[model samples]
Target: MESYKKTNKPRILNIVPISIGSGEVSLGPLYISSALKKAGFDSVVFFPDLSLIMHFPIKYDFIQHQLDYIMKQIRPEVVTFSVLSTNYNLSKSWAEYIKTNFNTTHIIFGGIHSMIEGENIIKLDYVDAVCLGEGEFSLPQYLELILNNKLTQENSLNITYKLKGKIINSKKEQVFLSLDEYPFPDREPLKYYYREGVLDSANFITGRGCPYNCFYCNAAMLNQNKGYLRFRSPGNVIDEIIEVKAKFELKKVIFSDETFTMNKNNLFKLLELYKSKVNLPFECQTRVEAINDDIAKELTNSGCESITLGIESGNEYIREKYLNRKMKNDQIIKAFHILKKYNIRTNSFNMIGLPGDTEKTIWEGIDLNIKAKVDSAACTIFMPFKKTPIFEWYQDKKLIIAEPNTNYYENIVIKHPNLSKLSLFFYSLNFNTLIKLESNKFKRMFKVFLWVKLFFLLFKGFLLKLIKNPLKLIAMNTFMKNYYGRLSVKGIIE
Candidate 1:
């Protein structure tokens, strides 16, 4: 690592999103990693084994080799753990293993999961600090402050020091709003993780947070109750997309933002910019309320060949009353029609058995999803996450059940007092199988291939166990669901 400011530059290492699909992603840590490097810190990245889903039943010994490779070659003075979802445990283990072997290396954990669960995470022996909320703005200045203070006797860095069993969360400053300011994601660098079989996938985040705070999600409250919906200028976004394509050989750039077409002016400008600069295929996740005829056509012209949408429930009552989603039933139908008119491959997400969910509502969702005839449909059971409206809903009703097992967290089926666990599971499974798979994308593109591959992979691993030991799977998923008495089974489709 090169020297900077007469002090040994902090050898910072970032762990990117470890999901088992595509290399060269630019979500949270990857963006922050780019920022840290631009700020002249010696930073390298390590992305753990990517799976289509979060986990597979395999003991990970290769992670040690990768960690050792980073430690020995880069010799980072500070090692940061980027924890997303339950993947924190894997990062925690690596952090502990690294620190155990080398006591001098400092460890800090950052990401949505850590930020929300910091109170629990900081107690672990390996972790030193948790960067709350966004880190591109917080991390750069945080490094400088800690270096100047040099609290050698203190136990923590960046965040409020945890001492004498008293803990404090770092006062978060501001989230970086300027997408132009962020360095182009290191596409070629990240491709090293899985370069050859790379499926020409690129993910870009144009905005953060959601406008409607739903009962089942965390992204809404992830902003700490600040008004939702923040975005970047069109010029900055276009530049980044072009940069990603040129450097990474990207065939499709997916805008992984919550609502890609929220602001009419910015979205139109972005669509125009994308049309002018690149003729690459792309996809995005959006709400039905946001996409009208004009916007759908604009998106299509800009090479939007595929899109994924969240149609949580077909029951209008659940959508409006329970989910905080304000879209009208006709609007959703109209939105699908517009996409279909544009000849775009559409994937609408559906959920079944939300609270007050009768068999009628589940059938409604199935009917709607089947009627839409989207390119694909994704489904999952609702899980109560901390800091969300739904979490409190469960807590208030005294319906909160604690499940010590990790498998339950996957939320395949809603656990409710009114619905038997087996009933919920079978309802979801049958509904999923009902969505007729046309395999249209196989003829049009290969997304269907990936989809099919992921389907079999799930059944091979988790589903296999569920088939053999249905009770175990139900127990695990139900416990992790954290459903209140007669918890509703809400679903998202993006």
Candidate 2:
């Protein structure tokens, strides 16, 4: 690796605030960096090596060393982090460390957490400013202002900062850029995506914003803007794919839209253009309600390899009352059947331990997934993230036991009136097994086996605690947290 010598060329570094092993080509930082580049400023994206931070015994010193190395190499004049609630504390700590050590460098926080917690975040002494709305729109303006020494609290739009011991919340409305006005997101930061001078797979968003108001998500909050649900024209999308294909061997594309099929006409036109011009196998995510026979047919004909549907919960009451998802179970089953009819692989995204979730309700969810006959399913515990409607609802009901931890898989933070954290943990361990075991004949035996396995795990945990082996115990818990869908019960029948 070559080092970029320190220069006075207004170098900017955008951080994803996660481990390098993830290999995620984050669109947020890429888009921001590209926007800055278009504005005539030098920018680079940095993904720190934090593999050691994944385990229970976090190697803080090693991570700090890696960060220091990158910071010294690039020597960015300004560092910006795209923060998420899951890594808010870690990002904060990193910011504090950078500000303390690299005192001259300016620090800016942006992303979902900052959009919701801007004023509070800017109150931190180390934070220079907090960016709200799309960075592609505000970041370039903010940087230009800083360069010209014209940046002031009154003039800042979509930015919150502290001035003269008082926090100034910008009153100006954010300028939203049309999708076509922006350049293609820079892909240089994602080294892993490029193999042998070809891109193995890439994630691109055709549009922004979702129509549904899922309480647990920030989409509803983001949709308040009049121009939130903007999309690039079908021609613009085709041009990007063709350009990328010309430059590299593109094996696949993943549309990371909130709802890829929300606009039926636009999606159909895009699919038609894509099929005729660039028929690369791709995947996308959409709501169950958005899928229909025509949509399925279009997707299949356009070389869609897979589709992920958000079937958050099985219980209708919980889906409607708690999550604001009003689709019926019949709709979900029908959608899956339609996709299957088109020979498209289906993956269902499910969540357990929601605010109103019970053992019976969780079982209902598993049963629904089985009925849907999904090829694959993923289940995650419900983490009450700050600023989400569910978190505020929980706060109103005094259900919050403690502030949410970084790991959503650790346990449920909310104090359910009926279900305990241990109970929810056990349910999460067995959730996938129940869905994959579709045979009623073997289900009874499987249920018994699951309980026995749970008891064995509990006993092992107790012994580890008794022996004062906290590190091993933490490792065991982490392993089990992600072990939901990996187990196979075919051996039992054999």
Candidate 3:
């Protein structure tokens, strides 16, 4: 094994602990890894086994073997796990294993889960520290302390540490970096997906954070309402896209911002620059409230092949009161109509099985997608994340069915008095089909194929588990690549 010791810098390994379905690279770890590399530290990002859903019972020995193999090669001094509430348990298990085998190695946790539960997570015996808020600047600073052998709880910003039998969170004020201060995320870790033809498009974020305080969304809770939305200059963004275009064979560009049309003037400038320079068909996500006729026209002119709008629930009461998205159904329908008018594709993101969800409400959601004539629809059961207002409300009502450490991708989290978990799962699985049926989008031949697809999905878990471990691993790899690779291009009809 090649020793990183020759570099005279501590080696850091970052693990992104999430199930991959869309073949998209995680930008969080890439940003921090790039910052560490720029600061002359040895850092690398690793993605463990990807699955369609988190609840699939892949073998522990296989998972451990993959990690052990990587550790033997890199032998990092510090191991960091980029965590989400859905994958916290998986990360905890890995962190504990690393601490047990490599007793001298330090383990750190970061990302949304850490921001919400840093103090509690740091209390774990294996976790040396939890990084709070943004880590691009703070993480490099933390590593400098480790290098100088001056590491202590008091010295780092945005870090919570355990020392001397006490948990200590840094008193230093957190520093927020401007978007341009960030170097382009290191795409080296994502090369495996590209080489294997799993990823066809590059995922980039022009900004960080969101302005809206949706109850179910963790953005507000993650930043603690510090007003963290910030975007890079249009020129800065174009430079990165130009660099990425040169580096890879990308078919499309995905701007994975929470709200791409947040600022009209800035967005227009970006569109103009993109149309003239990049000219590649790109897709982005935005709120229905952010859409207008002019915005829709600009998007299409700039080669926006698709735009995803969050229509979390169809029942107006459920949408406004429960999810805190105040837009009316008329506005959502209008947004989709305008995008479709301009020949740009539209996709709606819906959440079934939310609090106060009933069969009637679930159907209303499907009906709304049909009414809006959405080109594609995606649905997920709502997961109440820790420390969010919705989670607290669910707790107050005693409606949560899952355990405290439930997987984020669990089929159902809250138990409604009138709705069963099975019903909700059924609704989510058939959501798109129901919409297509109502909209008359499916032909007889297509309907037959859809039924077969639904059957495979309904019994997918059991079928995958029936396979032996070795075969299961191979089956899963091939399934994820083909399934998610198609999804990555679902919006592009041509």
**Predictions: Cα RMSD each:** 7.9, 5.3, 7.2
Query: What lDDT tens digits, residue by residue, belong to model 2 across residues 163-245?
Result: 56677787467657789998888766654435443347777889877777788886578778777778989889888888777
CA-lDDT, candidates in order: 0.65, 0.77, 0.78
Per-prediction TM-score: 0.78, 0.85, 0.86
By TM-score, is 1 or 3 better? 3
Candidate 1 stretches with Cα past 4 Å from truth are: 1-9, 17-26, 49-75, 89-101, 145-158, 163-177, 222-228, 397-414, 426-430, 437-494
* Predicted candidate 1 versus true structure: per-residue lDDT over 1-494, tens digit per residue: 11122246677777753432223353676777778878877666665544322334533555556557667777767778776553555677678888898887767888777777778878887776677656776677667655566443343333644434556555544434555566755554555433554446778877767776777776665655353356778888888877767666666778887588888899999888888897788888788878888988899888999887888888988887767877776777778878999998888766554667776687677667767766666665555666667667666766556421123323342356566655566555444544553222234365456457535643554566677786857654553343212122332111
Poorest 10 consecutive residues by lDDT, candidate 1: 484-493
Candidate No. with top lDDT: 3
Q: By how many angstroms RMSD does model 1 differ from the true structure? A: 7.9
The predicted structure with the larger TM-score, 1 or 2, is 2
Give residue 377's lDDT in candidate 3 (0 to 100).
85
Supply the TM-score for candidate 2. Answer: 0.85
